[model samples]
Target: MQSSISLPRPIPRTALAQAVLLLLYGASAHAQTPPTAETMLTPVTIRSGAEQENAITPVTGFVAKRALSATKTDTPLLETPQAISVVTRDQMEAQGVQTLRQATAYTAGAVSNYFDSRVDSFSARGGTVTQYQDGLLRIYGTYNTSRPDPYTLERVEFLRGPTSVLYGQGSVGGVLNLTSKRPQADTLREVQVQVGNNARKQIAADLTGALDQEGQWLYRLVAVGRDSGSQLDHVDDDRLVLMPSLTWKPNAATSLTLQALHQKDKSGSLIGFFPWQGTQLPSQYGQIPRNTFISEPGWDAYDTTNNSWGYLFSHQFNSDWTVRQNLRRTVSEVDYRTIYTSFTANAATGRPARPVFNSDNRTVYRDASWQINGGRMLLVDTQIEGKLHTSSGTEHTVLAGLDVQRNQTSQSSWRSVTAAFDVYNPVYGNFRPPTASQLMRQPNVEQRQWGLYAQDQIKWERWTATLGLRHDSAQTDTEGRPAAAIDDKAWSKRAGVTYQMDGGWAPYVGYSESFQPLGGVDVYGTPYKPQRGQQWEAGVKWQPPGQGISAYAALYQLREKNRKTTDPSNPLNSLQLGEVKVNGFEAEMQASLASRWDMTLAYALTDAKISRSNAGDQGQSVASVPKHTASAWLSHRFASEGRGGWVVGAGLRYTGSQWSGTSAISTPSATLADAMAAYDAGDWRVAFNVINLTDKVHITQCLARGDCFYGQARTYTLTSTYRF
Candidate 1:
């Protein structure tokens, strides 16, 4: 489906002038300073003293004590006010995470819905979570954006609550940030081979080292290629990814890094569904097999390609001041096609009747349909950061920058009817092929946006405070009969305070707001106002001495307004009076116990409702959002001191019942299990991991009336890695 609303043209002249002036101000402060004796003796790079410390932080275990995504600074996780979860590379590997969703499945306040396999779908606090990489937005061409392999990432971080103060526009639920592998001064090389059920075969490699003596130049290269089969019969998924980066430091206080990525994916059709009678509820027909293939073999196809490059640069003018800048550009394209059954015919004299399968696993269908679509997208981002210390007894870290983005996407689709297949016992090669003449071009949307933001962090004595503000302007343009156009602007802000005490404890409170431009107009032809979100949060964090545990808990309430909903006067159009409220509590504990045991435990309880709406959905629980979720993971390793190196791990996850699409219908609760074992010797390691160990079959979610999806079935994988 194409977006009905479009972004307008370039921002007003005033906005453009402001961006130029900001850039000039940053450049004017770059006066050259006399070379000191220490600077003359050795070349200093950007990651000098403080930067080098962060770069070398060990990432060998599940516990991530420090993160930069929360405050864009080297702040410890325990000091951040809002609820935050970090999944380190070690944690992902131990859990046998193959996809991005799997990496966050055990974190508090996070729910991963992977029934479709076509897109990365997840919800936090009753709203969809936005995607980010290294503090920058990761643009998606459509609902089905490609997911990066877990092996290519260093860690994944989740920041819960409204964050528009730092990021211009986003979801009220929060943001998920993936940190990529970057060049390092240390020499490291590793390779791994993996194989599992479903014909899964893959190889990955990581190499990083200093390009020259004195560690002035560093480089890193990562690559992965995989060929795997899906639980769906006759369906296959394959991908290839390549990433390379280079870092150069000319002096102790100056450094610059350049990085690039190229990825491609080929997969089978994503539209596979059975009617309500046979799938969601027991029909007289036999239960549909989890691996049933609903689409014709000849018509199923999906392919996408992406390319991106960017740079990170920073310089420390003196002990009290520093400046940093970042920029990136990306382009992506996709092509998808599929042919599947639409309606079913009854087992008795099936012809001409909306086909319904019978108890004997035999049925006939009235007909089928073919759908074809393709599109392209482009994205860009650039920003600058600065830090300063005042003459008074206070410290200041500030950021001022501008970002501009343009997205142009177009889709051409064709649909036609053909002969159908048996529901229980399927047959292929029956549907007729669709033709180009039947294809129709959808409305192409071109959206452009520009935002200017500034933030400051102030610290004095044992007290810390932060304040930020941002301004955004956007224009959406659509190409169709009338060539519709709309322009919008918004302002966002955030404030927070924290107090630190001696026993490794910190208590904080924060307030933030978010906004997102909506795409459609009301029945009266008036553009709908952008959706707005407001949140109030309070939390406490603790890190006990010598216990290796970091824990936190938070309570929050969020409300959103100006949402678009069905118009009562004209059922054909939309209204902007929709409102929603969500209240929740989240708690988490992660530790490396006694240097031999690692454990992580989390729990979340949420209550979400449609507070107001033009339609008749008020007072109902949000669809697909469970009220309670909990998880626990534990692992133990035996050292070589008394026995051969070995490790054992296990985990459990539980999700409570939730409204599927209406207050009257709901999906049942479920529990899942996972286990892993590994052995290490002589710089080599072997491991076996199992997901859904109990082989339980349950629906992750279902749509009203007839469409439902099953969660991942029991699966196992074995991997071997060697380091040199």
Candidate 2:
């Protein structure tokens, strides 16, 4: 255990020109425009079942399954057992995603790096991706933009390992749920349009109708716009999104749903830097000329603004009874500004423009939630159940529940900027943006969380069980007193056993636990204790109604309790010492066998470690996370029921090369290949996408003076949709 190798705190050009003049007021004074070929459609997925988040569901992560045609329903990452990856809405429109870090990029271990804007905030498996949409749990200062553009999604669940039980200050590296898009009862129309390359363009529209005509009430509206230009050099990307939703039913067990959203992102320079030691001076050394303008020529920048409102209610008073209620509220405001150049040890290569690190940031957020699911008791089915004895005949069924949440993220910033060369400045590129002094800052942060939960489900015989308990109280008010707070008590457990294998194959096994409450702190002063993740699972859940096709495989282990650092001779203090491990194995497959050849193949192999970092850097690994990951998808359809349907799809992604710091000094692995082609005629549709299909070239080393930073290259798109 030897520790020596750290660097990443060199962003100062007078503090990036007073953080770009404090975010340039309200931007768009006109000037600084470029990015748009076409964009309109707006779809962003986040909740689905009936198998299609890459198929293979047999209970492995946090339980949420129901299939009959959500493509087919395999969503049983097992009610929080651990390990989850689901991103479907026909695969985010056959791949054209523009955020949430590109819609979970092929999910596997779900590693994300959201191109700047402060890494667009994402970290999973090894932790730190604290974001929630429908159920609202927020954190992301200046929050950087709402980023809604997967066409208004309805699926995006990647719960692959560790969730503090309904969320309690999380991220042992896992949790992402975007699910938004509701109002369906009939009348639907989907439209699309796209053009590719760095000059890509897009347009999309979604319409789900029912207002009169005796259809109670149902409506859905989505809108989006985008413009792009990338390959670096001043960078570029522009966006706008708006979403509206409504759902209501008065019979068959009351129901109600309402949602609203609005987002805008006009960007450029979310930290764009090159020269991993100047790749000897070629990867475009210190480049930034595409018309030289890091924050002036309209100032290469980024902006974000968000607004949200929500509600979901359901009731089934009879027929064994049923009750559920949900509510939500989200508000966001981010006026982010940036001016590249995070130091490149001087510089020289394809260059001619420099300013360096600046920000006029602002982030504000509020989230609310309330949940309740009542109980019921029913019987009669094969007859033979009990609570201590049953053999001659019997039957039983029972269920119970309760839940609550109130989340928030309040941020305040009074930023400033100034820079004139600081990569060890020796004459660095043309540099000039604020030849003065103004190193100012106003890094303010606030967080508040509240959680209370209770649940139980028990069914006799063929055995099905569930038991959960959560009690968390969180409070944080830095910048105004009360630095940190958390009083958490969590326990989530589930046991499953299903057997009816008579050729259609059916097998199952399960158990689970996960919890979180640590927001980075170990420089002593103590504030890092509240990460209890535990897991042990077994698998097999095939065709119960898995009908048309189904499959599953599982084996897992994730344990925790042992952490301590920041005693470097007493800068503060920390100690927990003893225990941390991750073991894994997973497999999958989803129906349509001899019916159309639709498919989803899966694979996962992990062995993260720190067995005992007590020795400190002892065996590192598990930051940014990746031991082994995999995903595969194959699609096919050529129906002739009406002579108008043809589609083809392909996918692959593999990541295995961790270490971004901690003395290991960066190593951002890569393995990407994607393809999509479609042509359907009900109204009209077309597609063609080939991201990173072979333009691979990645690097993310960070040692500062020594340098290292390169990523983003390879893109293509072409689309069209019409439904009138």
Candidate 3:
């Protein structure tokens, strides 16, 4: 517990010196230009056919037919009526994904049963998910941000339930947009190298095209460098990333794009909390060695540094009207330290105190923490889109928007009570590091939000209706902290309908609403209001047409209200009456099958609980949620007779039993396996991947307020790619 703050150099050096002076002014204007003929036919008519199928382009495999975060327009996910999932960029390079929870590991009501390699703790149908990029918002606070690098993503969208009409407040379980990989006018180059097994090593690159040639100046650069090691033991998983983008398009009705991001993360903390009696009810000093390294290896750390820059503008006031704007600015920093297990006190069941072995069953007791977080964010979004047609012929499609957000945060913390290791005979430096009078400086928080939205979809003939509305105003300030300056206002609504039957199905139904504002106060200080949610979904979608396949199924009932619980007659105060409910079902399928088979399938069942509470855990069940989750993947390419081929894949993941929060301890069920092989010749490609293949030792959740979380073992990688 020693951190006097001072952490701010994980490379951003002035945004890499303004990205090397904008890459030497776009390489001296394309090596002092010279081409013509409308710059040689403008990169073959600028991304043909509906601009290559809108919504952040790039999809040729793992089916994705338009999506702009469920109705931020660009529709079509079978006419969007909620429930959306798309993980594309060729399905995260054929499932060799590295984070973003492994590219939504077969998403379908998404959930990422904790195994934190420093954040990306996801959840969807059972609440908490917000994190948008390119569609604005990217977390505001908590463990200070920075985590986005699935090779700088090209897709990953999930928009399940309550989206607050169009992204305002958040988390009634949904929205996880992330689509970055801009600037492209054809040409692309790639280079990749990777090696696996905890000793991992990596390199990556992806460059995009036309800086001139009248493709209206496009450019892109993506880079990644990594050094890894995990599966516990003295943890480490490093990373450095840089992303650059530029686009100008000064013709076909105006456009702009400018993006930048720098990321750094030298990690540690692959989440360890141990206890739960040697992990999930086991004892006699057995268990707890899934590559154990319970913190304190040079004092555990989870470093982070992030920088961002943005722009995305569009204009086209003709052929139907359009206007768009998006902006971003982010700065983040974090340096967290950790140690684990520590408990005491159970004066006749006042709780906490269980796990005091040591008569040779191995010592325990520990505690430590040191955090220094920082954040800054600014986001703006402005929109207007239209496509009318009235005269009783229906066909609307309107959208209106205004969005703004600002956040500034700072925190410093420290805690202590260490020394007492030996989780089965082990030892470490005697321990001691909490000083500065045990610092705890928090109060430099600021948050501001603004939202105003409207939407319409209409259409007639095959019927499709969708309406939305939103209004939000929020504020939160604290400078020296006495906490008071929390203002919130909300209004959100959405309605949906769809019917486009005639072979490719489309039935849909929706109703959404969400709000969130609660900050703190109870014990009579009162000041916690805002946390309302509602959802009722119904879905069915199928995409037959040209048959690259797509399918969906959904059924839902979500609820939330004030939620805070535990003041049952002042047990240390906290009350909002609390309520939560989730009843769900989801199914998904994506296919490129038959043309060399590529498939995906997912299933979810969730039935989260706690419907109304005054602290007596009403109906429990909803911690790391999992009432069955399933996944499947299949791949096959095999062609080889010239341009080269041969690809193989296999996958499966399942999680069933849960509960360990409203704990009556229940954490069983697990299944994992994944494999992949690749080869291609005319552009060199090579791959081999594996995930939890058999070295499975489960336990991804545990917490009756005493540790446990581990899953993910048996990882492998080997990749080599080249393309020009």
Lowest lDDT sum, 10 consecutive residues, model 2, at: 375-384
| Candidate 2 segments exceeding 4 Å error | 1-83, 86-95, 98-157, 160-235, 238-266, 269-297, 300-437, 440-500, 503-509, 515-528, 531-540, 543-636, 639-645, 648-677, 680-724
Q: Flag regions of model 3 displaced more than 4 Å.
A: 1-67, 72-115, 128-172, 184-210, 213-215, 222-233, 242-269, 276-292, 295-386, 392-395, 398-425, 428-456, 459-618, 624-702, 705-724
* Model 3: colliding residue pairs: none
Of 1 and 2, the candidate ranking higher by TM-score: 1
Candidate 2 residue-wise lDDT, 580-623, digit = tens: 67777766654444334555566666666666654466555555
Which of candidates 2 and 3 is the stronger one according to TM-score? 3
Q: Give per-residue CA lDDT, model 1, range 1-724, as digits (tens).
A: 4422232344434433443453444344334453465443233223312223342243656766678777766677655667788888778988899888789888998987655556776789988788888777785446335667788898898998887776767778899888888887778788999999989998999998889997878998999999998778877778899999998765566666788989888877544655555666776655777888877786676666777777666655565455555555666666666655444434565533333443344553434433343333333344445556678888777767666666666667765545545667778776676776777778767777778788787788777787889888777788873425767888988888888888878888988889887866666778778889999999988877656677888899999888777877788888778888999999999887655788899999989898988778898888888999999999898884422389899999998887877543467789999999998774688999999999898777766644566788888899998878
| Per-residue lDDT of model 3, residues 164-274, tens digit only | 778898878888889998877888799999999989899999999887776778888999999998888888888999899888765565566889889988887776577
Judging by TM-score against the true structure, name the best candidate.
1
TM-score of 3: 0.32
Better of 1 and 2 by lDDT: 1
Q: lDDT of each model, Cα atoms only?
A: 0.73, 0.50, 0.79
Task: Give the Å shift of residue 431 in candidate 2.
Answer: 20
Question: On a 0 to 100 scale, what is the lDDT of residue 541 in model 3?
Answer: 91
The numbered model that scores best in lDDT is: 3
Q: What are the models' TM-scores?
A: 0.89, 0.29, 0.32
